[model samples]
Target: MSTDTDTPGGDADTAARSLAHWSEAGRAEMEAFYALATEDYRQLALAADWPTVLRAVTHDGWRVLDVACGSGKFPTALDRYTDLSALPEASYDLLDPSTFSIAEARAQLRPPFSAAREFAVTLQELPADAGPYDVVWATHALYALPPAELAQGAEQFVRALRPGGLGFVAQATAQSHYLAFYDAFRAGVRDRTPYTSAEQVADALRAAGGDVRTQTVEYTSGTADRAVAEGFLQRCAFDDAVSLDQMEAAPVLGDYLAGCRDASGAYTFQHEVMLIWL
Candidate 1:
């Protein structure tokens, strides 16, 4: 087995450049937005079925793979819930293409946790040595991948998992309330990637030879402050084709933000989570 990194798309430079401007300042801005957004990271963590999945793997030590594991948050959270001392010995592989994210994960990780490994490679080019993990996790990552690429990644995920092993693939559904907001916000923006619906994702998994189950997790923001709304808008306005000025100028942006802030002044968003087994 070899663990060579490959970027099948050959677009690492483009991706790195596009993400380079998102420095610590940008992260602070995004964190502020996350704090204000109707659906906070805490809610996403709780609603993501992490606890359930961990329970499933707690009995025997399981080699886990977290694809696009941002800031190592999910794995860290899993450690907290599973109680590292009581669980069987386990190794975690954190894979992502962002150097900044990998750095953050390394700094945040506690002892006994697996060392963070950086990969500027895409899912299609996952390292060959990652084979046959007991659990494969791709939470909130697949939605960012192109549909075709997502399918390819899913195939890789299944191949990497042992037979009867579990895989969790969470994606944003077309029916999500935030779809309208995202669509209007990215209107006319070139190189913008749209989210794939849950149905499309489940079908792709089935084609990849897995039995899949799905759930809808809904969350609402309880605050309607304009600063929060603007922050949310700014965090999402990172595509090369879309400028922050254009986003601010869009009439639809203001209207949609207002609509999201209900009588209580909170913005709410929804997402779909898919669970599969190979």
Candidate 2:
């Protein structure tokens, strides 16, 4: 695996600082991400939850680790699927870099719905007691990080897992349909990084000394109308670049939005979710 010294938005310090601060712009971006994502993503993500992955693992007490456990959605979903049997009284550590996301996860988790015991911490600094986890899960989080950080994060996951324990890292592939909007939005404005393919991710994990296997899961969503498109756009439009001022000035933005509003008045999207295991 080769490392790119020229970071995505320039220097490492700048990128780190930008990520660390969780500025209003960053929050806006997340909001946009959620908005544009929720409609299509919720179903796709849930569908990716194949029970065979969990059923194959046999551990004494299922201690789980959810890396980049944004809003605790996947963990919560897992709890619902496993129920009182097979996955009773499981422990979960939700690791993420954004305090905003952590806070959201905390707020979202409550009541009988909250079956798995949970905790939240940043990726670089996980709690000392978090480990020896039986099952490690990382879904859609690796795409945000650069190669070096991703490698380091993988090491952390390995360290947290017990011998013979299972670790699954789900990465979005380059062929995902959202790349259309993302690429067009970044064209001529800034250099936006694309997702690493499953093959590349499998190679990287193997190079990093993890026994790995890969699978590609394709998902397609039903067409969404103009209202849905607007909602999606609003949900994912964050930062000054996607702000009202920028949107007003960029003719392409209008064109893109119009294009999203198809002749049938419904927008369609497709995605490839890659599952890697160790």
Candidate 3:
């Protein structure tokens, strides 16, 4: 039932396996990049909102489903909220298209739930009778969804949630680093597929009949080395085989990187993310 959540197959596959670029070394490099970049982010406390959202929708224990749960970071961030050990008999359902991600999330997530299940699939592929969850969420994982399917995915979110169930999703805004960089990448590198944006998702969700709310926050990330910046961009584009030199050689990519560089020669990326809820 999934639309385009494959691990970067071919022309038939509309989405790339984004996590493919996130190997151990790449993850380390990204952490280094983030250390230098996210200090000024307004919504630094992104995970703290989960419990608040969970409480607003249902006072009962959570039957939580994390869509595209990558590396279990969202569950890790839950520490800022209530202790997972103290919550009663909660249930966790992990949904993702990556076996690697599902495994990592399972090993890393220490949810307070007494029972947990993992679905190695996308939201669109989830079974019709998976039960209306108390809370269903997709964090930064919707990037791979094709533009045409955004509305269908939004409807899936609504269908997954039970009565009064709450849902939360965080995504990079249209003007954010991810979208902007990809816009430049697609224009200059390859124009095969379009990037899915939070604005588009919000509009589609609202049109699908949900009471959607959005909040934006700013953040910055930087690096002093061009090579480091290039590596980050390559990973973002899910093409590690391509060197930074090649990227710079491309007219559009090279120009985009040039604009992102500052007087100090450090590469800085400014991002605005939207916290969407209903």
Candidate 4:
């Protein structure tokens, strides 16, 4: 899960530093990240018939807002998995704190996902008149949102949707590899709070008066290539400074990685993601 939003809390400065670091990450670092992380979007696409789902809310001159749209992987996955030609054209606005990410995402858009507006701001800072969009989504995004700002972010998410409009968020649960591994990373390396979980997202949305429904999708992503696994894990933690050798030797994180490794030395990352509908 990639994050493009800022956090608000006692750790806000630390969070901002992390976001800034990610924004300035080199091209090679970003490419390495997506090498394994692209599966995140692929899995979400396989979870549903996206075209039919989007078509349900499609109307004349309809539009969608993609919150924290990092590299537009969700739309890319949708284009790959569905018949985009069958869906009517719709404007897709992107919102994110990183201009680099917004630009990368914008370049990936195609018909039915015509790139329209770009908002270089955090989700909480979305314009008051932003939208009553036909569809709003944050796929594999929002993990960096701190607990203190979740309520406000959730409210903004719900507020952006038109009545009967679709809202979707795909995130890993507390039990999933993403969340569990991050907790270990904090204990062993960073000493920061864990990334936000799907459970928390659902709770925040419900608390914000959203009618939320959830479904679970389980899978594993593995690699026999140590370099690939290393890149993936580093990106997952958003700290490339910590190498694979370091992670494998770390205390809590080392133990966690051992559990994910096979006798053949392959790494299999288990994922139990929650598909949330609002």
Q: Best-fitting candidate, measured by TM-score?
A: 4
* Candidate 2 C-alpha error for residue 245, in Å: 11
Tens digits of per-residue lDDT, candidate 1, 3-62, equal 212222232322333355335646866565556442433444565455455556544556
In order of appearance, the predictions have TM-scores of 0.75, 0.71, 0.83, 0.94
lDDT winner, 2 or 4: 4
User: Against the true structure, candidate 4 has what lDDT?
Assistant: 0.85
Local distance difference test values of all predictions, in order: 0.57, 0.55, 0.70, 0.85
Compared to the true structure, candidate 2 yields what TM-score? 0.71
Over the stretch 180-248, how does candidate 2's per-residue lDDT look in tens digits?
Answer: 444545452334454334556667777768889877778655345444444444333222334433542
Candidate 4 clashes between residue pairs 3 or more apart in a chain or in different chains: none
Residue 183, candidate 1: alpha-carbon lDDT: 66
What is the per-residue lDDT of model 3 for residues 1-278, given as tens digits with 9 covering 90 to 100?
22344243343243544644334545765554445433422243453554554556554566888888776666665654345454545678888877777776778666564338888766767878786888787877787786667777788888888877777788888898888888787788765465678898788778877778888877777788877776677657766666778877887878987888888878878888788887
TM-score of decoy 4: 0.94
Which of the two, 1 or 2, has more TM-score? 1
Off by over 4 Å in 1: 1-25, 36-41, 44-52, 58-61, 79-85, 110-112, 188-191, 239-255, 263-266, 270-278
Which candidate should be chosen as best, given lDDT against the real structure?
A: 4
| Candidate 1 accuracy as TM-score | 0.75
Candidate 1 lDDT at 129 equals 75
lDDT tens readout by residue for model 4, 26-112: 556667878878888899888888878888999879999999898789999988977768788898999988898899899999888
